[model samples]
Target chain A: MVVKVYGPDYGSTKGVLLCLIEKEVEFETVHVDGFKGEHKQPEYLKMQPFGLFPVVQDGDYVLYESRAILRYFAEKYKNQGTDLLGKTVEDRGLVEQWLDVEAHNFTPPIYSLVKIYFASVLEGVPADPKAIKENEEKIEKYLDIYEKRLSQTKYLAGDFFSLADLNHLPFTSYLMNEMEKGFMVRERKHVSAWWDDISSRPSWKKVLQDYKNPYDVLKEMNLVN
Target chain B: MVVKVYGPDYGSTKGVLLCLIEKEVEFETVHVDGFKGEHKQPEYLKMQPFGLFPVVQDGDYVLYESRAILRYFAEKYKNQGTDLLGKTVEDRGLVEQWLDVEAHNFTPPIYSLVKIYFASVLEGVPADPKAIKENEEKIEKYLDIYEKRLSQTKYLAGDFFSLADLNHLPFTSYLMNEMEKGFMVRERKHVSAWWDDISSRPSWKKVLQDYKNPYDVLKEMNLVN
Candidate 1:
């Protein structure tokens, strides 16, 4: 099946691309630059009302939200490739549970850590030390929980490497590489091992090779004013 | 089948209760007061390591996160009552897409608005107008999208009321009733109509009639400090 993905090259976009690759899906891309207001235009809004991306259109059926799109692809092509969800109902529950953890728990703190500390520098604003300190404590607490979970099981859902683990790649990669917080992952042995396992997956490697870093583009444009 | 849910009488907790009621599933609850740190105890952490709740234990299996618990109960009891997910692959995808919207898009801004204003008052701090103004704008934009979508379909996922629609109940009710922002929902005609239709469901009405508000308990106990 042919799929059309609309988004700029960003962290959220990589998650969908990685899902597509894992499923061995063929797809074309239509880049919609947020800075250019392309994503906010009426046409893009028709497909993705939230004005975020990447949105996937397989013929007339369209879906958005990176994790939701990943899930749609995984469920649609469950038999064609590696099963990323799980094999049983309980496993499915665990997978959904951890995915919710990633969305509701893991993401917000790390994102604030990034925005308050690093992205603010990109925008030529002084970093808020108090904000950074508070967010660091929050992120540390979240990762401590991750460490315990990873120590108990090989992956977030369980022994299997599921979407629960895969969903963390994009943001964690940004934290380790761009934000230079490798210690955040590395200090926790189980989390580090878990990261090493998932990040080394062929699909994730493909995501690394194919997807461009938005931060690098922002740097090149020298848009910090 | 008997299910036991562990959580306080908060918004997230009600989402699971509503789901169970909708599915015609029998469940009992053990209230875990967040103000008392009961949720963070070793016993509660064993069932839900994240220390947040609406965790449901059915026989031997346990699940957490209100939405995940809802999905588990819905799937396990799909044949017993109303189907809360969807019938086909496309429908399931749609349901998931909107569920993510509620999780990632709709919930965050509303929660932030609550924390910034009312919850801050609980901490003896004046509400920051700047943060409130920003978050209110964000909430407005998100609700506009919801309005447009509800105008097109009878519910978030489609004409049928699914978990996606049900998930909005707890937070929307809090915003409308507790926060006195009923105007936010009432202002958009289609959204207002959709709310009227879904909130009128016997299941949701029961949730309102039975579940106690955490804020009320906190007020009674003078625990806000």
Candidate 2:
């Protein structure tokens, strides 16, 4: 049975979509429109108690948390399309370590920035300049660490592109393209190259081509003009 | 050779210590005093660029990120001591899912509370009541979800006690015992029980008996009254 993924077509859902495509796993998306509060509906909440995006149902097994879903498909189909988890135990350890780094360090600041920049646009409230500046500083400090690490290794985990690097896609895309913070990536030489390399991957390209971002969906629904 | 863990004996370092003990892996501590800015030194930055607590060195392989270290040792010693990563792919997926939840949803607010509550105690500054209240509400909301999940299963991932459950030890202990927020755990029946159950594990008991918290070290160093 093809896996059924329930969520909007953007954000973390796109991360999961990119992973599935890379792993050559067959899956279909069941959109739960967050703008409409459909994710908070009891039916959707059954799969994801927190009513978060991108819950995957593979046969009798169900899972949420996009990173975990990415790991699941990567591990389940290790040899098929992409070698995501890496080959050895040590490599896998580094991958897991950097994955946590992305979760704890990288995503938070970028997520805050996204909320400050984009959510303000949506909610019609003025963004707090102080909070935005603080978040940018945090991101710069973190990316400096990444810049150093990426100088040594081609990717965050190692030379191979693992889930650690892949995990940064959704929010970093917001940082780079949508939020007008591309300099955060472009200012650092190795990081800029790394972003270009990973973002241009065929899998990510295919995801971009197929799925509409959340804002686009809102425009289509006449929720935002 | 016994693994060498570099960091102080508290906070995230203790999480790795708990995992090592549970897995029956022999290890020694090399304290990097954060209060003294030792973690930010050039040599320590070589291992962990971000200068975070608890970087583990198992022979030549050095790894940081407390959760990742837990997963690493858990995988390496899977057949020896406690089985943490679960038995099958689906089980492992669930374990990874809850681990992410603990990292993303659970830890952030609790961490913020820790900094707000405990850091104030250390810095001799007045704790911000508004920020504390906000963090408390965030933690309470996340715990409500955990309460529902724990009501169904003995642990976060499943009936088996896995890393997902174990990862809650460090901060939750601070919240429960030290930070005077025991009511957060005590308020939720299932979550309170879950906390009691996980906290009573012999491995955690040993960690508490063996290690000193940062404040204790500060007092010993004549840095704090």
Candidate 3:
């Protein structure tokens, strides 16, 4: 049986879907519209207890967590193309390190930006300027590290465009295009160049097309910026 | 040359130290006393800019991040004993999944508990009662999951004890004994049993001894209940 991924079009899950598309791997997409409460239903909860998007099922094995799903797919379908985990033990460890950095260090600030700007505009809550500023400062510090790292290597993981780089595309793209008007990767030449390179990919274009405007759905609930 | 780990004796880095002990891998420890601001020093920051503990320098290869360090040691010292990453592709993926779960789901609640009751006290701030209550509730929810999983498998990765189980010990141990007043795992039969079994191992006992006054250190700060 082919692998099946259950998730929305855009959002963070788009990273995994984009990866699958990039590799041209055969899989089924089970759309669970987040705005419609389909993901919260009992049946879906069985697949993912957290009621989160991007749950992948391969035969009898089911797994959630977008990063894990991406890693699993890449390993399972190594023949599909690029090796995201890396070719050597040290390289793989470096890849894992950067992936963790993305999760622990990078994602928190991005989530803060989403919550303050996107969530408030959509959910009818007052966004805290202090929180947003704090998060931005954190993001800037990380961007400096990325800027330095990218200056040396073409991709986040050495020469190859591994999962480490691909995994970060969804959020960085959203930050640049939709989340905040002032957000710009162009300040960092290497990061900006890499962002443009990844964003221009055909698979990424498909992701942008699929992601529906969450703000529109929020408007229905009388939640507006 | 022996593996040299630069980290404080007790901190988040303890997880990597425990892994080294469990594998019976010989290594030298360099104390980066966090209280003295050692981690933030120029030399230490050069190795890990994040200023975190448990940075391992194995000869010429320098690596940070506790999970990555654990995996590297497991792979490099494969003959030390148990193959924590798994022998098969699916097994390794499952191990990665559980590790991700540890990073995302498990650690947050535990940290919440630590921050509310322990961190505030350690840093000499008043503990928030409401935050403690909320964290305890969250800890309970995750413990139920751990109980259920432990009931079926001897260890987190199955019959064989893997890195997944070892990776969790430091946080879970601190939560159960020092921070949560031993109430976190005591009520769950399977979890409690597993804790007793794992904690009693010679390797784990050595780890505990390495960190002096385990509870008293927190108690001195009035962080332990």
Top candidate on lDDT is 2
Q: Estimate each model's TM-score.
A: 0.94, 0.94, 0.92
**Number of the predicted model whose DockQ against the real structure is largest:** 2
Winner by TM-score between candidate 3 and candidate 1? 1
Where does model 1 exceed 4 Å of error? A222-225, B116-121, B222-225
Worst-scoring 10-residue span by lDDT in model 2 chain A: A114-123
Report how far off residue B213 is in candidate 1 (Å). 1.2
Residue B158 lDDT in candidate 1: 83
Q: Write the per-residue lDDT of candidate 1 for residues B40-83, one digit (tens) a residue.
A: 89998988877887788889998887877877878878898789
Can you tell me which runs of candidate 3 are displaced by over 4 Å? A181-183, A211-225, B213-225
Model 2's number of clashes is 0
lDDT of 2 at B91: 94
Off by over 4 Å in 2: A218-225, B215-225
Candidate 2 on B42-136: residue-level lDDT in tens? 99999998889889999999999998998889988889999999999999999999998988888888888777755766677788888989888
Write model 3 residue lDDT over B121-193, tens digit each, in one string.
5666888888778877877887887788888888776777777778788888878776645867888999889
TM-score, prediction 2: 0.94
For candidate 3, the TM-score of chain A alone relative to the native chain A? 0.89
Model 3 CA lDDT for position A188 = 86
* Better structure of 1 and 3 per DockQ: 1
Among all windows of 10 consecutive residues in model 2 chain B, the one with the lowest summed lDDT is B113-122
Relative to the unseen true structure, what is the C-alpha lDDT of residue A142 in candidate 2, on a scale of 0 to 100? 93
Instruction: Put the candidates in DockQ order, highest first.
Output: 2, 1, 3
Isolated chain A TM-score, each model? 0.93, 0.95, 0.89
